[model samples]
Target chain A: MNAATLARTRGSLVGRPRGAGHVLETLAAWALALLWLLPLVYAFWTAFHPTEYSTHFSLSAPWTFDNIVHAWHAAPFARYFVNTVILVTMVLAAQLVLVTLAAYAFARYTFPGRDVAFALVLVQLMIMPDVLIVENYRTISALGLKDTILAIGLPYMASAFGIFLLRQTFKTVPRELDEAARVEGCTPLQTLWKVYVPLARPTYLAYALVSVSYHWNNFLWPLIVTNSVETRPVTVGLQVFSATDQGIDWAIITAATLLSVAPLLLAFLLFQRQFVQSFMRAGIR
Target chain B: MTRSREWLHAWLLLLPACVLLVLFTHFPAVANLWHSFYSTPKGARPARFIGLDNYRALVDDPIFWQALQNNALYALGTIPLSIALALLMAVWVNGRIRGKGFLRLAFFTPTVLPMIAVANIWLFFYTPEYGLIEQVTKGLGFASHNWLGSKSTALACLMVVAVWKEAGFFMIFYVAALQAMSPQLAEAAAIEGASRWYFFRRVTFPLLMPTTLFVLVNAIINAFRLVDHVVVMTRGGPDNATSLLLYYIYEIGFRFWDPAYAAALTMVLLVVLGAVAIAQFVFLERRTHYQ
Candidate 1:
């Protein structure tokens, strides 16, 4: 445990200083946390149990992967998973390259209208591409790129948030590094590649995690743009699968939900600290 | 070696991003306004300038009014509760509580899961009879509640889901802010025989105002951004009870093929977001900080 946590544990164990109120507060906290986690916990329970036991909650219920198998077979989940992975990777790749170059320019170069350009870029922070779906959809259609993975990723390729975060990180890089790289006969782009990019690894990592999780879970734009199984992301897939008029079947629905979110959920569980810290370090609200 | 080279290289580096940003964000924002003044073309007809017609229709549309009111209420319902709950979660997680790790995980798990996926599970939870809540209510000898199906309860049900999805995410910000706080202040307060509640109210809450303001802006934006759960859970059902502004826009733009109307709806949303952004900037500028 961290020293702070160790201190907390010691403080709680030495209960002479803290009174009944502390105990009550701890109980209340745990209760709220449990309430917060109830839905996901219930999903796990329902997913593992048989259809009959989904609602019954019997202690002796037989465990089965039948629901998962059924859920998988019931939808094109394999294709959806592949599509989502491709979509997230494409968006992240484009964002990384575009944001890095843009940030480098803003960080190092004194150019005409630079402040105005940066201000224009920052407009996307408030007016995200998702908000301009109608016009973007029109644009995508005009380009005959509708129902493609590229269309899904295109609008988000130039991410203002990514550029902003990278610019902030790049600005903190000492000027000496750039001068040193330049003295070593490296061009500006090479200096950025060799110096700025390496120094800004942590920011890139944080931004990548944020971007991947975001596009992976992004639904509305993708839902509007892509129609077929070839391009539908997991979120849209899961929505279509669960919103069927086949009536409510908790077991299968939960299994499908779990399947769709399993990769992200597993990653978060394994890298819980990194996931939380990256978000904090990114300063994203 | 010259200043012109620096400018040239900078423009070269910025060109690709600038192109895409203009194509997507900047261009679309302007296009949304421009299109709002035109009529959406039907087959064999062209989009023509129809100034104020779309806005006039919007003024006449009850669904527009309903969605606007619902979105406003949704914002009102989710923002404060989520922020308060987030602060509570952060304080608890930051405290000398047992199972801090588990509590932290529990609170944050929601933040990681996609809203679309979770809405399905919540769809079950709000299912009429065999749902979790229904099971509890039935066990207590009460009527089964069709939380998502009933018009009266649908928006509130969606608000609860939004709050659940948001609070944990907001808690991470609060946690970071809280962890950065000086423990020496708490020790000093204790030495002065200050009550915990008094110390929190007088010292901690004031210290957290900046974080609160930051989180508040985010909460407000999310109140509009996150309509995924509404899509999965209700689809703005029971006669548009759960229709937020974005969802309404989606319906008009995609489902109804009324881009002009959607563009007008989007203008309203953009204006709101712009106002919030400006307000946040002003707030940040004027914020007071106590070490």
Candidate 2:
């Protein structure tokens, strides 16, 4: 105990002794941060500097916002921005109802084939609808929801991840709470509404945030389902904007790229801690 | 109400999602497996069943071989580097860092951004001239080079970008796992004259085993699932060097409009994913049993 106290006292004076391993580890960490920031750094440099100055990073170089104006004038990013918001909201709204009801069932019921049915739904998690584009396309074409926001949102409405997450949350609610509500002469549905749904509020919020971010970044499904610029999401539009055969204009492309990610970036900046916590609580890696 | 009625209502609630999953996911996977065996002539109605022909054809197909090699290389390259880097970042952020929140936000922001957006940014970074890399290289008097335009370097560049985008997301998981661990263990080790490296490797790392395994499986899966950057940034171009397995499947299924061949290739992918699933369960099962 005395030795422990002595070490604790000296710990602040002499920092953790330098080691080959720690040196390597710190270098590796900085390397990773650099790697993640490489594109952003490049983009920032290009965005600030002119075309001639973009190639050479002299400290006395000139910089301008010509790229931003160029990119802004090239497309109606505002419309794409609104479309993404609508798509995320539409999908999340439908998912809450479908996943909540499905979760309540799995959590509360002891039905035949419950396990198998739940597993079936979860296959969507592994083999996403985007992979089955040929079939999904046929389905969308048949529904006549093609080239519309509804089509972009439809396949994602019944989310397996939401169902699984909600089920886990619902199961944590104590049995006695449900029993008390039922004994108060409430119906089964009424008990669920009063006791269970309210209890699972945090899980609901976490799932909604995850679902919203997911749909906001979703690309391939929206790409295939929508053709017209009027209905396209940010991802599809960005792809088209950047893929000109003449090759990308680095400064303007970075500006456009930054514009595309601005919303989620702002939201995440505002709720960075909560966003990190949500992933932790969700047990997602 | 009664127990039986409650059960019925439960099924009723589950019915809609179950049906949709069945049609879109489960049924399609099964149908894809079936379709892999048949031949549908272009512009014809009836299809002829040819068992093993498609799979055999895939064996001889050079692009299939290239794609398989690329994906295996991709999984091999990205998983260990990113996971190790993620562990490092987590350990650092878990330490007494002054700007942990800001650093975490910077690390994680790319993941929330659409891949296409990131691809565009990286496109500028990999630009033949006037991009940051070329600028830096040329400033130092080295010859400026195209990072993604060449077949030799494109996949490596893609792997680097991929590790960048994903490492933070993985780091967040490890940080949570590390934070949830009691500080007592590390403190005890410090008193015993144990170095920080020893403490981390011997005590902290062992405690984080379950999380490491979890992250490993996820990182492996993401290695396969995410080739969007490849598709957008490189288009698997320059002699198909960056032609990853899934993108090749996309090309076959959507661009080439040959769903049968794509189905066969997807079967191969399913087999690969199944192997990963087995590793996760088997490794975890053995660890638990030993414990």
Candidate 3:
């Protein structure tokens, strides 16, 4: 080989080491990923197969939907699913409207005590309704919303994180858009609805995904507030179903676990890219 | 006239959110502090102002102290490990890896699944004998360990679960941060004969400190906030070994029906979270960046 060709080949070897170490690292990564996924895989396995096969990995184990059928009959899963769907939808809807109005005020109009009001709003970021369960429970009951789906969604309806995120997104919208809408005879609310809201659609989407995921998975407050099957969300419902009093049937519990998580999991699988990108865009770690 | 009208409109817009915020977060926070000083009313007894009695009770309560210590240890253990593992995961996935999508999905799946539901599955993993963990250890000729049963291992078992659940979520953030980084930094480091380890240690880590702090804050809050797994898997059991602060507070507030003492416990949580919130604000305000 010529000197220049020799140098080029040598440089490639110097910079890029395709050695056993790289291979080992890749294997280690894959191993850990597999390990990370093992629990869910096991859940699916146990849920599909017989109870005897739950702890054992048997290739000969016959698959059946018996566990799922038993689990479904064992509890009001369909009702729980409905309650969860309604809870998340109610919470998300309320949050959108409230945060939109509040975010608009914060983003555009500067009224008296705006700074103080904003500071007060930010206080919710630290002391969430989840943390103040004792008193909030009292407040919910006082409002006579006890054991209701409304109570589960009420405290979180005004999300500080949602307001903060939307305001940030709103602040980035150009003055020209708002001004152009105003010049076109739109009211302030009209300008927000038509110009600002549309411009911040991506932010809205991000916040919605984050909100939905959070409330859907939220447990403690719902566990406290909702007592009856009529109002209990899936998280609470699953806990009640799988409690130790039922004697820990792994197959049935796994089936119910799969059932409870299936909607969100299915959505995540289908829209994995958006779910991840929304989280990144939403700036929530 | 228009200016006053504008002010009215702004207040009108802010009303609903502000009212809900006050009712849920602000009012309850203050009320929790206020009520902690009083005696919780029993059936026929009215609540009486017993100044510092509840705090005194909290101080004397061994379970409270145990919960506090366990929580401190839990936070300390889970935070650094998760954050470090997250950074490591991000680095691996961001590089020349095959099946990046599958790896990312695997890492992130737990975040999407509810902790309560997943804890039930992990509960099976930690089950004593003929359980997944036991089966593995037995196959390896080791003793069948009660991963979540024995007092010595229960908290650690919960910590492992928390770390597994959180590290992946944090990885997404780190991944985002790493991707946003200019690739030229790595090229320059490689040109300077910097080993990958050395480069990550000296260059990548320092640049990612802000994200690290953000993730750290989140991990801290979550350490306190998320006791759902504890509720499911352990119930602070085998003598409250796995009882976290929040779980204890829940027991005190709800199960035991001692809202006053629970309020006291909550004050402790609030104080810690408040400090964290302040730190976050200070850090964000500084907007620390690197060259």
What tens digits encode model 2's per-residue C-alpha lDDT throughout A20-73? 755765665566566666667767777777866655668887778888788877
Error of 1 at A205 (Å): 1.4
Complex DockQ per candidate: 0.60, 0.46, 0.53
Off by over 4 Å in 2: A1-35, A48-50, A58-65, A245-248, B44-46, B287-291
lDDT of residue B14 for candidate 3? 93
Candidate 2: true interface contacts recovered: 0.51
TM-score per prediction, in order, is: 0.96, 0.91, 0.95
What TM-score does chain A of each model score against the native chain A?
0.93, 0.87, 0.92
Tell me the tens digit of each residue's lDDT in model 1 across A1-285: 998876454433322227698788888988998898899889999999989888888789999999999999999999999999999998898899999999999988999999999999988888888788999999999999999999999999998888899999999999998899899999888999999999999898888888888888898899899999999999999888877647747798899999999999999999999899888888743
lDDT of 2 by residue, B98-176 (tens): 4555567667777777777787777777777766778678879999788898888989988888877778888888988
The better candidate by DockQ, 1 or 3, is 1
lDDT of 3 at A31: 99
lDDT string, candidate 3, B11-76, tens digits: 999999989999999999999999999999999999999999999998999999999999999999
Docking class of 1: medium
Error of 2 at B18 (Å): 1.0
Candidate 1: stretches off by over 4 Å? A1-17, A245-248, B288-291
